[model samples]
Target: MRSTYILSFLRISVSVLFYILLVFSVLFLVASIASIAGNDKAGDLTKKSYSYRVKAFGLQNTNEPFTYSQDSMVKYQKVADEYSVVLEPSSTIGYYALIMKLVYMALGLVILWNFKKIFKETSFRQPFKNTIIKRLRTLAALFILSDVIKLLDYFLFNSYLHHSIASTKFQLLTDVGNGVITGLVILVIAVIYERGKELEEENALTV
Candidate 1:
Protein backbone atom coordinates (compact mmCIF):
# COMPACT_ATOMS: atom_id res chain seq x y z
CA MET A 1 0.00 0.00 0.00
CA ARG A 2 2.80 2.42 0.78
CA SER A 3 4.48 1.56 -2.48
CA THR A 4 1.23 2.15 -4.31
CA TYR A 5 0.97 5.56 -2.70
CA ILE A 6 4.51 6.37 -3.81
CA LEU A 7 3.69 5.41 -7.38
CA SER A 8 0.58 7.54 -7.22
CA PHE A 9 2.57 10.50 -5.99
CA LEU A 10 5.08 10.14 -8.78
CA ARG A 11 2.35 9.89 -11.37
CA ILE A 12 0.70 13.08 -10.12
CA SER A 13 4.01 14.90 -10.05
CA VAL A 14 4.72 13.98 -13.66
CA SER A 15 1.24 15.07 -14.66
CA VAL A 16 1.85 18.45 -13.07
CA LEU A 17 5.10 18.79 -14.96
CA PHE A 18 3.36 18.00 -18.22
CA TYR A 19 0.80 20.68 -17.53
CA ILE A 20 3.51 23.22 -16.85
CA LEU A 21 5.20 22.38 -20.13
CA LEU A 22 1.93 22.70 -22.00
CA VAL A 23 1.38 26.19 -20.65
CA PHE A 24 4.94 27.21 -21.49
CA SER A 25 4.69 25.83 -25.02
CA VAL A 26 1.50 27.77 -25.68
CA LEU A 27 3.09 30.96 -24.37
CA PHE A 28 6.09 30.42 -26.63
CA LEU A 29 3.85 29.99 -29.66
CA VAL A 30 2.16 33.25 -28.92
CA ALA A 31 5.46 35.02 -28.41
CA SER A 32 6.85 33.70 -31.69
CA ILE A 33 3.85 34.93 -33.66
CA ALA A 34 3.97 38.32 -31.97
CA SER A 35 7.67 38.61 -32.73
CA ILE A 36 7.13 37.78 -36.38
CA ALA A 37 4.29 40.23 -36.69
CA GLY A 38 6.27 42.95 -34.96
CA ASN A 39 9.10 42.43 -37.41
CA ASP A 40 6.72 42.78 -40.32
CA LYS A 41 5.48 46.11 -38.96
CA ALA A 42 9.06 47.30 -38.56
CA GLY A 43 9.83 46.40 -42.15
CA ASP A 44 6.85 48.40 -43.31
CA LEU A 45 8.06 51.39 -41.35
CA THR A 46 11.47 51.15 -42.98
CA LYS A 47 9.90 51.11 -46.44
CA LYS A 48 7.91 54.17 -45.55
CA SER A 49 11.11 55.85 -44.43
CA TYR A 50 12.27 55.97 -48.05
CA SER A 51 9.80 58.81 -48.71
CA TYR A 52 11.05 60.73 -45.70
CA ARG A 53 12.69 64.03 -46.58
CA VAL A 54 16.44 64.10 -45.96
CA LYS A 55 17.29 67.43 -44.27
CA ALA A 56 20.89 68.43 -44.70
CA PHE A 57 22.52 71.89 -44.72
CA GLY A 58 22.72 72.59 -48.47
CA LEU A 59 22.16 75.46 -50.87
CA GLN A 60 19.78 74.98 -53.77
CA ASN A 61 21.82 73.83 -56.80
CA THR A 62 21.20 72.57 -60.32
CA ASN A 63 21.61 68.87 -61.04
CA GLU A 64 25.06 68.00 -62.42
CA PRO A 65 24.01 65.29 -64.90
CA PHE A 66 22.60 63.24 -61.94
CA THR A 67 26.18 62.69 -60.76
CA TYR A 68 27.65 63.68 -57.37
CA SER A 69 25.37 66.21 -55.67
CA GLN A 70 22.94 66.65 -52.79
CA ASP A 71 20.21 65.05 -54.92
CA SER A 72 22.38 62.04 -55.58
CA MET A 73 23.17 61.70 -51.91
CA VAL A 74 19.44 61.69 -51.08
CA LYS A 75 18.74 59.12 -53.82
CA TYR A 76 21.50 56.83 -52.62
CA GLN A 77 20.31 57.12 -49.05
CA LYS A 78 16.78 56.27 -50.12
CA VAL A 79 17.95 53.21 -52.04
CA ALA A 80 20.01 51.96 -49.13
CA ASP A 81 17.12 52.56 -46.75
CA GLU A 82 14.73 50.61 -48.99
CA TYR A 83 17.09 47.67 -49.19
CA SER A 84 17.56 47.61 -45.44
CA VAL A 85 13.85 47.79 -44.83
CA VAL A 86 12.99 44.97 -47.22
CA LEU A 87 15.62 42.73 -45.70
CA GLU A 88 14.58 43.41 -42.11
CA PRO A 89 13.42 40.38 -40.11
CA SER A 90 9.78 39.37 -40.26
CA SER A 91 7.67 36.24 -40.28
CA THR A 92 8.18 36.01 -44.02
CA ILE A 93 8.00 32.25 -43.60
CA GLY A 94 4.23 32.88 -43.66
CA TYR A 95 1.69 30.20 -42.95
CA TYR A 96 4.22 27.48 -42.47
CA ALA A 97 5.52 28.98 -39.25
CA LEU A 98 2.01 29.43 -37.94
CA ILE A 99 1.05 25.90 -38.82
CA MET A 100 4.03 24.37 -37.11
CA LYS A 101 3.35 26.40 -33.98
CA LEU A 102 -0.28 25.37 -33.93
CA VAL A 103 0.64 21.75 -34.30
CA TYR A 104 3.00 21.88 -31.36
CA MET A 105 0.51 23.76 -29.23
CA ALA A 106 -2.26 21.28 -29.97
CA LEU A 107 -0.11 18.30 -29.15
CA GLY A 108 1.01 19.85 -25.88
CA LEU A 109 -2.56 20.50 -24.87
CA VAL A 110 -3.63 16.97 -25.68
CA ILE A 111 -0.81 15.49 -23.68
CA LEU A 112 -1.60 17.68 -20.71
CA TRP A 113 -5.32 16.92 -20.78
CA ASN A 114 -4.80 13.20 -20.96
CA PHE A 115 -2.28 13.34 -18.17
CA LYS A 116 -4.77 15.11 -15.99
CA LYS A 117 -7.32 12.44 -16.77
CA ILE A 118 -4.90 9.72 -15.78
CA PHE A 119 -4.08 11.51 -12.57
CA LYS A 120 -7.75 11.83 -11.75
CA GLU A 121 -8.27 8.12 -12.29
CA THR A 122 -5.43 7.30 -9.97
CA SER A 123 -6.88 9.58 -7.33
CA PHE A 124 -10.11 7.58 -7.43
CA ARG A 125 -8.22 4.33 -6.89
CA GLN A 126 -9.17 3.02 -10.29
CA PRO A 127 -7.64 -0.17 -11.64
CA PHE A 128 -4.49 0.70 -13.54
CA LYS A 129 -4.75 -1.59 -16.57
CA ASN A 130 -8.31 -0.61 -17.42
CA THR A 131 -7.76 3.11 -16.94
CA ILE A 132 -4.11 3.63 -17.80
CA ILE A 133 -3.59 1.90 -21.13
CA LYS A 134 -5.72 4.33 -23.04
CA ARG A 135 -4.13 7.28 -21.27
CA LEU A 136 -0.65 5.97 -22.00
CA ARG A 137 -1.50 5.49 -25.64
CA THR A 138 -2.83 9.01 -25.83
CA LEU A 139 0.32 10.35 -24.22
CA ALA A 140 2.50 8.38 -26.61
CA ALA A 141 0.64 9.76 -29.59
CA LEU A 142 0.91 13.32 -28.33
CA PHE A 143 4.59 12.91 -27.57
CA ILE A 144 5.24 11.68 -31.10
CA LEU A 145 3.12 14.42 -32.58
CA SER A 146 4.95 17.08 -30.60
CA ASP A 147 8.26 15.80 -31.88
CA VAL A 148 7.03 15.95 -35.45
CA ILE A 149 5.84 19.53 -35.03
CA LYS A 150 9.11 20.46 -33.36
CA LEU A 151 11.08 19.18 -36.35
CA LEU A 152 8.83 21.09 -38.73
CA ASP A 153 9.17 24.25 -36.64
CA TYR A 154 12.94 23.95 -36.73
CA PHE A 155 13.10 23.61 -40.49
CA LEU A 156 10.62 26.36 -41.27
CA PHE A 157 11.71 28.85 -38.63
CA ASN A 158 15.45 28.40 -39.05
CA SER A 159 16.11 27.23 -42.57
CA TYR A 160 13.42 28.81 -44.70
CA LEU A 161 12.98 31.95 -42.63
CA HIS A 162 15.08 35.09 -42.66
CA HIS A 163 15.17 35.75 -38.94
CA SER A 164 18.30 37.03 -37.29
CA ILE A 165 20.85 34.25 -36.95
CA ALA A 166 21.00 34.60 -33.18
CA SER A 167 17.25 34.61 -32.75
CA THR A 168 16.95 31.51 -34.88
CA LYS A 169 19.46 29.64 -32.77
CA PHE A 170 17.76 30.74 -29.56
CA GLN A 171 14.36 29.62 -30.79
CA LEU A 172 15.74 26.25 -31.80
CA LEU A 173 17.30 25.73 -28.40
CA THR A 174 14.08 26.61 -26.57
CA ASP A 175 12.04 24.28 -28.79
CA VAL A 176 14.48 21.47 -28.19
CA GLY A 177 14.26 22.00 -24.45
CA ASN A 178 10.47 21.97 -24.54
CA GLY A 179 10.49 18.72 -26.51
CA VAL A 180 12.97 17.04 -24.20
CA ILE A 181 11.15 17.97 -21.02
CA THR A 182 7.78 16.91 -22.40
CA GLY A 183 9.23 13.61 -23.57
CA LEU A 184 10.75 12.96 -20.16
CA VAL A 185 7.46 13.63 -18.43
CA ILE A 186 5.69 11.15 -20.69
CA LEU A 187 8.34 8.55 -20.07
CA VAL A 188 8.08 8.94 -16.32
CA ILE A 189 4.31 8.65 -16.44
CA ALA A 190 4.57 5.48 -18.51
CA VAL A 191 6.88 3.92 -16.00
CA ILE A 192 4.57 4.77 -13.13
CA TYR A 193 1.56 3.41 -14.97
CA GLU A 194 3.35 0.15 -15.62
CA ARG A 195 4.33 -0.15 -12.01
CA GLY A 196 0.74 0.37 -10.95
CA LYS A 197 -0.32 -2.36 -13.31
CA GLU A 198 2.24 -4.71 -11.83
CA LEU A 199 1.02 -3.92 -8.37
CA GLU A 200 -2.53 -4.64 -9.42
CA GLU A 201 -1.52 -7.96 -10.90
CA GLU A 202 0.41 -9.01 -7.86
CA ASN A 203 -2.53 -8.16 -5.61
CA ALA A 204 -4.81 -10.22 -7.82
CA LEU A 205 -2.52 -13.22 -7.64
CA THR A 206 -2.23 -13.00 -3.84
CA VAL A 207 -5.98 -12.78 -3.44
Candidate 2:
Protein backbone atom coordinates (compact mmCIF):
# COMPACT_ATOMS: atom_id res chain seq x y z
CA MET A 1 0.00 0.00 0.00
CA ARG A 2 2.84 2.40 0.77
CA SER A 3 4.53 1.54 -2.53
CA THR A 4 1.27 2.06 -4.34
CA TYR A 5 1.08 5.57 -2.99
CA ILE A 6 4.72 6.17 -3.92
CA LEU A 7 4.12 4.92 -7.43
CA SER A 8 1.07 7.15 -7.74
CA PHE A 9 3.12 10.17 -6.67
CA LEU A 10 5.95 9.38 -9.09
CA ARG A 11 3.56 8.81 -11.98
CA ILE A 12 1.92 12.13 -11.33
CA SER A 13 5.30 13.89 -11.08
CA VAL A 14 6.58 12.36 -14.29
CA SER A 15 3.36 13.25 -16.11
CA VAL A 16 3.53 16.88 -15.04
CA LEU A 17 7.24 17.29 -15.93
CA PHE A 18 6.78 15.56 -19.28
CA TYR A 19 3.96 17.83 -20.43
CA ILE A 20 5.73 20.99 -19.27
CA LEU A 21 8.95 20.06 -21.05
CA LEU A 22 7.01 19.03 -24.15
CA VAL A 23 5.44 22.45 -24.44
CA PHE A 24 8.74 24.30 -23.97
CA SER A 25 10.53 22.04 -26.46
CA VAL A 26 7.94 22.85 -29.13
CA LEU A 27 8.15 26.58 -28.53
CA PHE A 28 11.97 26.52 -28.57
CA LEU A 29 12.08 24.57 -31.81
CA VAL A 30 9.76 27.01 -33.54
CA ALA A 31 11.58 30.08 -32.23
CA SER A 32 15.01 28.68 -33.07
CA ILE A 33 13.93 27.97 -36.62
CA ALA A 34 12.54 31.45 -37.03
CA SER A 35 15.66 33.06 -35.57
CA ILE A 36 17.92 31.06 -37.86
CA ALA A 37 15.85 31.89 -40.92
CA GLY A 38 15.73 35.61 -40.23
CA ASN A 39 19.25 36.28 -39.02
CA ASP A 40 19.66 39.49 -40.99
CA LYS A 41 18.00 41.60 -38.31
CA ALA A 42 20.41 43.08 -35.76
CA GLY A 43 18.15 42.61 -32.73
CA ASP A 44 15.26 40.18 -32.80
CA LEU A 45 12.96 38.89 -30.08
CA THR A 46 13.05 35.38 -31.52
CA LYS A 47 16.80 35.16 -31.06
CA LYS A 48 17.38 32.71 -28.25
CA SER A 49 20.50 32.40 -26.15
CA TYR A 50 22.34 29.15 -25.36
CA SER A 51 25.05 28.63 -22.78
CA TYR A 52 27.94 26.16 -22.62
CA ARG A 53 30.33 25.28 -19.82
CA VAL A 54 34.00 24.84 -20.71
CA LYS A 55 37.43 24.66 -19.19
CA ALA A 56 38.86 28.01 -20.15
CA PHE A 57 40.42 31.06 -18.62
CA GLY A 58 38.64 34.30 -17.94
CA LEU A 59 39.28 37.72 -19.47
CA GLN A 60 41.01 40.24 -17.28
CA ASN A 61 43.24 43.28 -17.47
CA THR A 62 46.95 42.65 -17.38
CA ASN A 63 49.59 44.53 -15.37
CA GLU A 64 53.30 45.02 -15.99
CA PRO A 65 54.27 42.03 -13.82
CA PHE A 66 51.43 39.63 -14.76
CA THR A 67 50.29 39.45 -18.33
CA TYR A 68 47.27 37.46 -19.55
CA SER A 69 45.85 36.55 -22.91
CA GLN A 70 43.04 38.68 -24.22
CA ASP A 71 40.95 38.53 -27.35
CA SER A 72 38.14 40.62 -28.76
CA MET A 73 35.58 37.78 -28.85
CA VAL A 74 36.40 36.01 -25.58
CA LYS A 75 34.45 37.89 -22.91
CA TYR A 76 34.48 35.99 -19.62
CA GLN A 77 34.93 36.78 -15.93
CA LYS A 78 37.28 35.01 -13.56
CA VAL A 79 35.78 31.80 -12.27
CA ALA A 80 36.99 28.69 -10.53
CA ASP A 81 37.94 25.77 -12.82
CA GLU A 82 35.39 26.53 -15.54
CA TYR A 83 33.66 29.19 -17.60
CA SER A 84 30.14 29.62 -18.92
CA VAL A 85 29.94 30.87 -22.51
CA VAL A 86 26.69 32.38 -23.62
CA LEU A 87 26.07 32.12 -27.36
CA GLU A 88 23.43 33.89 -29.39
CA PRO A 89 21.22 31.98 -31.81
CA SER A 90 22.62 32.74 -35.22
CA SER A 91 22.70 31.05 -38.61
CA THR A 92 25.97 29.21 -38.11
CA ILE A 93 26.95 27.52 -34.84
CA GLY A 94 23.80 28.53 -32.99
CA TYR A 95 21.54 26.53 -35.31
CA TYR A 96 23.41 23.29 -34.72
CA ALA A 97 23.47 23.94 -30.99
CA LEU A 98 19.74 24.52 -30.98
CA ILE A 99 19.14 21.30 -32.91
CA MET A 100 21.25 19.32 -30.48
CA LYS A 101 19.41 20.88 -27.55
CA LEU A 102 16.05 19.90 -29.03
CA VAL A 103 17.28 16.36 -29.62
CA TYR A 104 18.54 16.08 -26.03
CA MET A 105 15.22 17.39 -24.77
CA ALA A 106 13.39 14.85 -26.91
CA LEU A 107 15.50 12.05 -25.44
CA GLY A 108 14.62 13.23 -21.94
CA LEU A 109 10.92 13.32 -22.84
CA VAL A 110 11.08 9.79 -24.20
CA ILE A 111 12.86 8.53 -21.10
CA LEU A 112 10.24 10.11 -18.86
CA TRP A 113 7.43 8.66 -20.93
CA ASN A 114 8.95 5.20 -20.64
CA PHE A 115 9.10 5.63 -16.87
CA LYS A 116 5.46 6.68 -16.87
CA LYS A 117 4.56 3.60 -18.87
CA ILE A 118 6.44 1.25 -16.56
CA PHE A 119 4.89 2.77 -13.45
CA LYS A 120 1.42 2.52 -14.97
CA GLU A 121 1.89 -1.19 -15.75
CA THR A 122 3.61 -2.22 -12.50
CA SER A 123 2.48 -2.66 -8.89
CA PHE A 124 4.03 -3.92 -5.68
CA ARG A 125 2.29 -7.30 -6.04
CA GLN A 126 3.25 -8.00 -9.67
CA PRO A 127 6.13 -5.85 -10.91
CA PHE A 128 7.61 -8.12 -13.52
CA LYS A 129 5.89 -8.08 -16.91
CA ASN A 130 6.90 -8.44 -20.55
CA THR A 131 5.89 -4.86 -21.26
CA ILE A 132 7.98 -3.63 -18.36
CA ILE A 133 11.00 -5.53 -19.67
CA LYS A 134 10.60 -3.98 -23.11
CA ARG A 135 10.22 -0.51 -21.69
CA LEU A 136 13.26 -0.97 -19.48
CA ARG A 137 15.34 -2.06 -22.43
CA THR A 138 14.09 0.94 -24.36
CA LEU A 139 15.08 3.21 -21.49
CA ALA A 140 18.50 1.62 -21.40
CA ALA A 141 19.07 2.33 -25.07
CA LEU A 142 17.83 5.89 -24.75
CA PHE A 143 20.11 6.58 -21.82
CA ILE A 144 23.15 5.27 -23.70
CA LEU A 145 22.23 7.22 -26.79
CA SER A 146 21.73 10.37 -24.75
CA ASP A 147 25.33 10.20 -23.59
CA VAL A 148 26.57 9.61 -27.10
CA ILE A 149 24.61 12.58 -28.36
CA LYS A 150 26.07 14.75 -25.64
CA LEU A 151 29.59 13.81 -26.69
CA LEU A 152 28.78 14.43 -30.30
CA ASP A 153 27.31 17.78 -29.46
CA TYR A 154 30.38 18.73 -27.50
CA PHE A 155 32.78 17.74 -30.26
CA LEU A 156 30.79 19.42 -32.97
CA PHE A 157 30.44 22.62 -31.02
CA ASN A 158 34.10 22.61 -30.14
CA SER A 159 35.10 22.05 -33.71
CA TYR A 160 32.85 24.84 -34.86
CA LEU A 161 34.38 27.19 -32.31
CA HIS A 162 37.92 26.14 -33.22
CA HIS A 163 37.31 27.04 -36.82
CA SER A 164 35.20 30.13 -36.23
CA ILE A 165 36.85 31.74 -33.22
CA ALA A 166 40.49 31.73 -34.15
CA SER A 167 41.76 34.04 -31.42
CA THR A 168 40.44 32.19 -28.33
CA LYS A 169 41.01 28.69 -27.06
CA PHE A 170 37.95 26.87 -25.68
CA GLN A 171 38.46 23.32 -24.52
CA LEU A 172 35.68 20.77 -24.49
CA LEU A 173 34.79 19.65 -21.00
CA THR A 174 32.16 16.94 -20.49
CA ASP A 175 31.06 13.91 -18.48
CA VAL A 176 32.41 11.18 -20.70
CA GLY A 177 30.39 8.05 -19.76
CA ASN A 178 28.09 8.69 -16.85
CA GLY A 179 24.95 7.65 -18.67
CA VAL A 180 26.58 4.49 -19.96
CA ILE A 181 26.88 3.25 -16.39
CA THR A 182 23.26 4.05 -15.67
CA GLY A 183 22.17 2.35 -18.87
CA LEU A 184 24.15 -0.78 -18.04
CA VAL A 185 22.54 -0.94 -14.61
CA ILE A 186 19.08 -0.61 -16.15
CA LEU A 187 19.90 -3.37 -18.64
CA VAL A 188 20.98 -5.66 -15.83
CA ILE A 189 17.72 -5.00 -14.01
CA ALA A 190 15.78 -5.79 -17.19
CA VAL A 191 17.58 -9.12 -17.46
CA ILE A 192 16.80 -9.93 -13.87
CA TYR A 193 13.17 -9.01 -14.42
CA GLU A 194 13.06 -11.31 -17.42
CA ARG A 195 14.27 -14.24 -15.33
CA GLY A 196 11.75 -13.35 -12.64
CA LYS A 197 8.98 -13.31 -15.22
CA GLU A 198 9.92 -16.79 -16.38
CA LEU A 199 9.86 -18.15 -12.82
CA GLU A 200 6.55 -16.42 -12.19
CA GLU A 201 4.98 -18.04 -15.23
CA GLU A 202 6.37 -21.43 -14.24
CA ASN A 203 4.86 -21.17 -10.76
CA ALA A 204 1.50 -20.18 -12.21
CA LEU A 205 1.53 -23.17 -14.51
CA THR A 206 2.43 -25.50 -11.65
CA VAL A 207 -0.42 -24.19 -9.49
TM-score of each: 0.46, 0.81
Model 2 misses residue 3 by how many Å? 1.3
Candidate 1: tens digits of C-alpha lDDT, residues 175-201:
445555666677687778788888989
Quick one: best lDDT, which candidate?
2
Off by over 4 Å in 2: 37-39, 42-47, 57-81
Worst 10 residues of 2 by lDDT: 59-68
Who wins the TM-score comparison?
2
lDDT scores in order: 0.56, 0.80
